[model samples]
Target: MQNTDAKVIDVALKYGYQSVDAFSVAFKRMHGIPPAEAKKQGLKLTFYCRLHFALKIEGVDRMDYTIIEREPFTVVGIRRTTPYGGGTWAIVKSNGNNVTAEKFFGRFYDLGLCFGFGQDGSNDYMCAVEYDGETIEGFDSFTYPAAKWMKFEAKGSVTENVLGSVWQRINNEFLPQSKYKKSDLPTIEKYVSWDEAADICNVEIWIPAILK
Candidate 1:
């Protein structure tokens, strides 16, 4: 584990925080897993942090890991079979649509959460299914370009409250104040443990971002 990513709980507790739930969400969003699970999996965490902006406060904990580069891969999965909205309901429904794809390939990617592209703030967009490099019926493979990405780990319910709040913070607070700019790469959520999301879930959010 690199010293760059430190545990976040320490800071939260220092600031008189009592709710592990909230602290866990903030920690995972920054590190990619709960403090307990991160220790269990021995996953290193690393990312650039700006302290002047309070992007992180003192006593704020982080994971210890190096920021390593990763190559891009192609994923293929079924398109939406129904008129799915672009909200939590739509994303979850389209991802979990187990038609013939699951049986043929054991299990396509776990019911990962997804968001569709839109012109503005509209839900009338096309949702997608993710493939873990495995082929399935009615699924076409699409490749996302490889680029330096800003990744964060998070856990908890895929509820609109949690995710929506995070998105709002990133778009409204974080990006605008930081020297980095948001890229066009689509947002994604990869859940390593769906069942234990509340307590300990492995959530990785990747966004293509470049420094100004």
Candidate 2:
């Protein structure tokens, strides 16, 4: 599903509805806002440069900004096909591989975005701060180091939009908010990617960082 359609669904469910029109009615009643209002809130997805596209920095307002001690771990993952509003493991499975969970021990970042929290209940779980960039066939294996993590959260239907939204937000708002005084580290997103048949994705993003 596209971002627009996903927003419509979220609004409808929030207001309680068995139908789209009924949900729209309830939406306007509760918030005195129309369902279209959600869609009208067009978020910026492009930044100053194409290479640096923009995304909405979510969950930032809720960050604790307090440091927490973390232990390191290893994660075995694969860089499979991830569509904008699709499933990651599902696509890989369709290609005839089972979703294998690895003993991923690494730094965990709290962005409030997990796989099970989204439409696809399977993708949500932990967010990795750092992982070995080694690309292996069928799957990738890597280890993350203990570091300060900046977590960003976002809500969207299509999987791709969620990633893009957070990326844009970081580049436009969060980075500048800190006066570019902080160090930039690995940027990772926990998202779902399904086959062409599936749509809708929820994402959580974690970028390594430290106070300037």
Candidate 3:
């Protein structure tokens, strides 16, 4: 926009935007003015330079994970759309319908049927168990194909910080540096053990993946 001679549509395409209108919307968001308004000589503009990456050891803590092939399976249970970090444990504990994890899945599990926001965000979650071939009223189901997944362990009581840290490591540190890309299968969070009386939880996060 600062360059009077530069065509807005041409510049928009160079940066991967599909159209000039889209680019102008993004421009106004960052500069507080549309492209046409940006031509004013005295108007101040916000400019950020390109980012550069460097090699450095990020943390001393280790992120331990294992890769395994899982057989295709189905789940049956209640589904809810929640925020990025919230899980369904509270619902399971309070339900008068006797909708416990043991009732559906034989164990505890959190399966993401689909993500919500764009660019690495939360998804639709199912408080489900292994499907028994019987459809219960008010319950949903999904069948996943066999695929290789990487599993990471998270221990400690259930809290935003404790659980969020595991996701942070995977997104910030592991995925950025690893030789694999996340697969299309729904992400799974399996609760290996839970003690509501003691507020203790042992969990595993499973991310389907393919070698890049």
Candidate 4:
């Protein structure tokens, strides 16, 4: 058996955790007990191994997407910087007065804009809309450069959590095995729902990429 503290530290470093405290918080959230406590109590611990994406005929599923080159555009809205996996989205969404795309930009189009900039979820999340070169008071603005994007459409019974799952699949399963590399640009989530109470709606996720 490995030493508990040593094992925790090693795992933390391997996973790019800043400190043991941060690692412990995430560990407890996932495993239902602190690492040290689990070690001391001699409780069984579950380990999640890394997943590898493979291109197989059986694994192939129809993923609807289209490639398009978009021109430079500016987005204006509220921005929040939060730690990865720290319930940042929950906090932002709960405080709907500050973070809202439709309210700020007005319901002109079905597409509501969101931009995520950062790796490992430790980054700025912006709920914004395309600005027509007009300034909005008390809002942050980000100008995106022209680039080729792979846009994936999600429709029917869409929710915030469901969109997140789609993003995970795109990153882990689709992108890894595809003939494309992610570019150094922010990912976009466009909400295309006009009816708030509707069971089905359309949404699009755009990821910047270059052919490899």
lDDT of 4 by residue, 39-113 (tens): 442244443323436663333444655566788888776566767532434554576733355566664323233
As a whole number from 0 to 100, the lDDT of residue 32 in candidate 3 is 73
Q: How well does candidate 3 score on lDDT at residue 74?
A: 84
Residue-wise C-alpha lDDT for candidate 2, range 76-193, written one tens digit per residue: 5434323323355444446543323232323222122222333443343332223445544544444556775555555555646655765666766656655223343334565433
Q: Name the candidate, 1 or 2, with the larger TM-score value.
A: 1
**What's every prediction's RMSD, in angstroms?**
10.2, 16.1, 17.0, 18.5
TM-score versus the correct structure, for each prediction: 0.52, 0.40, 0.59, 0.57
Weakest 10 consecutive residues of candidate 3 by summed lDDT: 44-53
Model 4, runs deviating above 4 Å = 1-57, 84-104, 108-121, 159-161, 194-199
Best-performing candidate as measured by TM-score:
3
Q: Which ranges in model 3 have alpha carbons more than 4 Å from their true place? A: 1-57, 83-114, 118-123
Q: Where's the lowest-lDDT run of ten residues in candidate 4?
A: 41-50
Per-residue lDDT of 107-129 in model 1, one digit per residue for the tens? Answer: 63543324454455444222234
How many steric overlaps are in each model, in order?
14, 23, 1, 0
Using TM-score as the yardstick, the better of models 3 and 4 is 3
| Candidate 3 global TM-score | 0.59
Tens-digit lDDT track for model 3 on 8-100? 898889889999999999988877788877655445454332234558444656566665677888877666665553444445457732345
Q: Which segments of candidate 2 are over 4 A away from where they belong?
A: 1-69, 79-94, 98-139, 179-185, 192-200
What's the lDDT of the predicted structure labeled candidate 1?
Answer: 0.51
